[model samples]
Target chain A: MVTETDIEKLALLARVALSEQEKEKLRTDVEAILEYVSDIRKVSGGEERAVPSLVNVMREDGTPHEGGVHTETLLSLAPKREGQYVRVKKIL
Target chain B: MSINLSELTIATARRHLANGDFTAVELAQSYLAEIEKKNKNLNAYREVFDDVLEQAKGADKKLPNFRTSKLPNLCGIPIALKDVIMLAGKRAGACSKILEGYVSPYDATAVSKLKVAGAIFLGRTNMDEFAMGSSTENYAYGVTKNPFDESRVAGGSSGGSAAAVAGNMSLAALGSDTGGSVRQPASLCGVVGLKPTYGSVSRFGLMAMSSSLDVIGPFTKTVEDAELLFDAIKGKDPMDSTSVEVSSSKLQVKSLRIGIPTMIRETEGIDPDVRKNFEDCLKQFRDAGHTVKEIELPTMHYALPVYYVIMPAEVSTNLARFDGVKYGLHVSGKNLLEDYVQTRGTGFGMEARRRILLGTYVLSSGYYDAYYAQAVRVRAKIEQELRDVFAGVDCIATPTSPTPAFKIGEKADDPLQMYLADIFTVVANIAGIPAISIPSGTAMREGKQLPLGLQLMAAHGREDVLFEAGKEFEKLRDNRGGV
Candidate 1:
């Protein structure tokens, strides 16, 4: 039931360029994979009993502490940093 | 007898350390030498701490009390840590170019606990970038090869840790399990990998990946070794809100009900040998006086879809901090968004980008409710099913993987195929249950020997069951002693 367009969209979303041959290979392979997942769908009902382990994990209110991150560590991850914060390209 | 010192479990190591059989300095140096020799081919480590000898030397002086059995269980053992864990003033990049050259100012809580336990910090093992892939192939450093066969993957995002243990480069290593990142690779590499119940181990120091599912565990050579490592590092931490202080029942294995999933046998692509070995294990359990029963967990089928949606959604949120303006590899551009995209596009490897994109899409405004929200509901259903199953069963058993280790690049070309590597292992994560992989038998790959593992999963907070069952199985396997 999967189409080339569907695969193409997925690829674009995933940012992997696929050639004609690659797409062809994926058509069969992905279909099989999807079929496997679809079988999983059967094992877990579509929506009836679907529930997650993490539920409303709320925390008590507390006074905010100053972020303990070393400025050097924070700035180090940035391509560029200003005095107090990371510098980014001007969007406006 | 000298070599025996290195092979000793943490428990035995502590005993010897107390008796002055060896100093911590000697233990650290021996492991360092072994790692240097074996790691050249395995590519298991990203960085070996230069201060290990100094740390060991200090420990040697304080060994008096530790030798007296009054100290923590890990006083003299050398435990390797995965690179994703924060270590004070040490590089802790989760094996990604984005976080290259980054060092943490503070130690991860687990690392701090292990340090306080008098454990030696060996080094950081490699991992999939941001803990994304099934094989260490996704690591920017390079793929970690299986210890048994260099041509095959060690199974990942904890591949490096598993390899370090299997290759005997470290006595024990810490690994994180989001979706079998620890257990699957442990299975493939023929080592013991434990994924503790969610909140059993604090995650204050681990790099975030699907926070709902992530838990820190160990990769070791034996079940007792795993328990030794787990005992030292597991406890509730004030920093990690999710962690709880639930002490497990120290019950022995003789009085337990082992459950095997009847529905899992119906899963497609399971290798016949793995299936047979799992059955053999069940039979052994029966012979050992443990009752084994078949149970139904119908909600398990939706695990993959729920995983795809929820994991991606969480990944998208967790990875948002790696913008170009932050502390990793970044590219600059005229516009902020352009800079962000280019930095991520360039810094992240293919697998990371793939997962990030999938996450972004699933959590995108338009698709959030339909895909991500629905997946959360599905996850709850899966959890509910687990509660139902656990009410009747003490632990569940399955083959860790559909098959044993595959060739290095066999499934690397296809992401979906690679994702399936964690399929059997993922259910444990989704339900926040504890699981462990132990060596069962050997599988032949292109005429080379490969080890297959049988995984046992237990209800939340019941790691004791896994250790009990694993110990019995180990005894049985030792008795059999065959190819």
Candidate 2:
């Protein structure tokens, strides 16, 4: 069962805010969903998850495009921007 | 002469365009008129492009060069795009308020290829927020109603795309499928939908819902039209390392074996009419001199459970980018932490946030090993089981959906009941195989005929087998004459 505290922590980890009402509603919904999917616990496949060789899989001969070719279009989408860089609140 | 839009196919459209039966501009006007008439009630398209006539006029110029082989098959055809797909300079928000009004910076690989093939974009269609839900009710926009019955839901996350084709608003449409997003809606709308083999079509432009299982598919009026759209959009791209080349195939399959999975008999929630229609379809196949056998995939039932775990885990990871920084809706809070939370809380719909929370929970420290890790193991087992089953049969057949289109808002409040709609369709995604949903027949619902679909799944890189089987079944369905 998912507790209120658990849903709160999940909200924090996922960077989503929730009200008391949404939290209570989400708690029950998550609990029911987990119960429905509880059968996944019975799986005993002994092997670890497969990891493909994505590293070094890129082609070498393809020509790289010029840098900042789309800087105007890319920066235009930002909510807040100054010059070329996107402005965000200070971390510290 | 007024063109009968419902009688049109990509093949017929191409032939007519070549023979000068009608100009591309006239064709575009026809579809635009249809959308203007039907879309208000059906809620099919999110935005019908303003440049449709211009695009068709350009194709008209190319028609003079047809004998040079420069003319493409789709050169004047009108197509709808799911809102999740990126077309450069066009808005694609995945039907979520978070990315509302966010214009795409570049064309998705498929959209770029479609432009090259001479297809005109009709516009973006509606979908579930972030392609998360089984029905389009979760969209920030209004729910997409069934074209046949306004009281019923057009099955989703690609509901808008399916409805567009089914209602004849567009000749064909492109949709992204993660766990039956394309096939389910196609089934409910009584149109043909194809989820090609994983990696067969490039996903460079589609919004990520579950990267592992995500694939872009087509919704069309006929299986042949589905093949045509798939052909235009498929190929490897340097931008997407996971994309692979799907060769051109003109396969003529003869007397192939089709498997009816043993789980079908045991699974619950299947409507009685759905089962009866499936049996009638099997009987037709048997009388046509094809082998019909019941095969077992021991881990078949585990597919839905594993999907719920793995999908959210990937979703939480993929959706983390929408932190009000680079693009989309931004809400300022006291600090950076509050900024992220507030923006996501208000921006995401209930279904999107719910999946995000479920995904975050499974990947959390204590529960990761139990839920996410275990799901990966079971997923692998399911893949192996499907491989074993496919070695014996060329294709696996089942009802595309357990039931036909349900009334709008019927399952809106219950997430679990909505999730059950994808139970049969998720197996193809889990195994990374090709699957197609063809309209099998219809069932009487509230005195209206609601269409049902027969889903055929083939082994990996075996879309040719599916296309052949689907076309053959279409012949039989035409003779029977119901849907």
> Evaluated with TM-score, which candidate comes out highest?
2
Predicted candidate 2 versus true structure: per-residue lDDT over B1-483, tens digit per residue:
567899999989988888889999999999999999989988999899889999999999987676368544688889999999999998889998999669999999999998888889999999999888777885469999988788999999999999999999999999999999999999999999999988889999999999989999999999889888888888888788788887666556589799998999999899999999999999989989999999988888999998999998899999999999899999999999989999999899888889999999899888898898888888888888888888899999999999999999999989999999999999899888899999999998988888899999998888888889999899987888857
lDDT of 1 by residue, B353-385 (tens): 556656766666776766666676677777878
Model 2 chain B: ten consecutive residues of lowest lDDT? B64-73
Model 1 TM-score is: 0.90
Which run of 10 residues does model 1 chain B get worst, by summed lDDT?
Answer: B1-10
Off by over 4 Å in 1: A1-69, A72-78
Clashes of each: 17, 0
Report the Cα lDDT for residue B43, model 2.
Answer: 92
Per-model C-alpha RMSD:
3.3, 1.5
Query: Scored by CA lDDT, what does every candidate get?
Result: 0.79, 0.90
Which parts of model 2 are misplaced by more than 4 Å? A47-56, A59-63, B70-72, B247-252
* Candidate 1 residue-wise lDDT, A1-92, digit = tens: 65788666765544344557756766665565444444433333445534333454567898556665566655655566677776766667
After TM-score superposition, the amount by which residue B7's alpha carbon in candidate 1 deviates from its true location, in angstroms, is: 3.5
